[model samples]
Target: MSYPHHLGMTVLEAGPERTRVSLTVTPSGLNMHGSAHGGLIFSLADEAFALISNATAQAVAVETHLSFFRAARDGDQLVAVATPERVGRTLATYRVEVRRGAGGEVIALFLGTVSRREKPA
Candidate 1:
């Protein structure tokens, strides 16, 4: 639940292997240039990744790489959908696509990995 609830993030779907999250760009979510902040976009994708990655056990982020295709502006609804690409013994990889609402164009792409933690002694 690391979503920016104060920013009005919406959880469209949450399941074992995939999750969908959304948010509308606003003044607070903007950068100096008046567009949605890149970090904010990344956070949206990361939230989706977090939901799908930690479904089984305690998992923490390993690494992430993101590429922005377009910038979303105020009033634009951004949707992030995360799906598992690989699940290994200890590490898992996921892909998150951030777009402008359903049927909208792709805006950002994110790939992240997380590692499961062992039980405490």
Candidate 2:
């Protein structure tokens, strides 16, 4: 599995059309409200979708829908699991759920779509 190291995040697992990802809350990873930033959570979800979408080949982001259910504060661990919802020749959709670690309280959910690129000739 390939682990992607990005600012404020890290990829925990990458596999065929699926990923298990996590990130820790840091001082800089917070919003004006002193909670984990929404963008950071979304980024983690995006990373999971990216890993799953391009696990086999090339893919590009098409669209995504996300909702924040609860606030993630400092010291809280954020984990996301991405699963394929639909896989077609041109497009793929994935559903990702973000949860609080240890207790498994869902904090957010994301539905992402990607466009699959044609293989090299």
Candidate 3:
């Protein structure tokens, strides 16, 4: 199984310009503070990022930045939505917003850049 599947993440939507992914927090995904680990949140955002970035081209993440605005705990469902900010010939930027539940409060924001790879001959 893919890593996102193993982590209980579900892709709600995927298109060339946008992608949405969701995850329900589990006990094992919690940090010492009883909230969801930052890494787990990052993973969720990255999953959406991966889907949107690769939908139109072969791409790999070159850099990423995430900022946490709130804490999520066990049983809290989180949704990440990724959309392209800019797409260039060789590089692209995407923005991901992770929120509590489907339309709940924003928990984190992630920005990622990807480098497109040349197609194999």
- Compute each candidate's TM-score over C-alphas: 0.91, 0.88, 0.95
Candidate 1 residue 97 Cα shift, in angstroms, is: 0.1
The digit string of per-residue lDDT tens for model 2 on 1-121 reads: 3333644456777886668888888887899999999988898888888888888768999899999999999988888889899888899899999988833998999999999977565
Give the poorly placed runs of model 2, Cα more than 4 Å off: 1-6
Clashing pairs in 1: none
Model 2 clash pairs?
none
lDDT tens per residue, model 3, 6-111: 8999999999777999999999999999999999999999999999998878999999999999999999999999999999989999999999988899999999
Q: Every model's Cα RMSD, please?
A: 2.2, 2.9, 1.2
Candidate 2, position 38, lDDT: 90
What value does the lDDT take at residue 115 in candidate 2? 91
Name the runs in model 1 displaced over 4 angstroms: 1-3, 117-121
User: For each candidate, what is the lDDT?
Assistant: 0.88, 0.85, 0.95
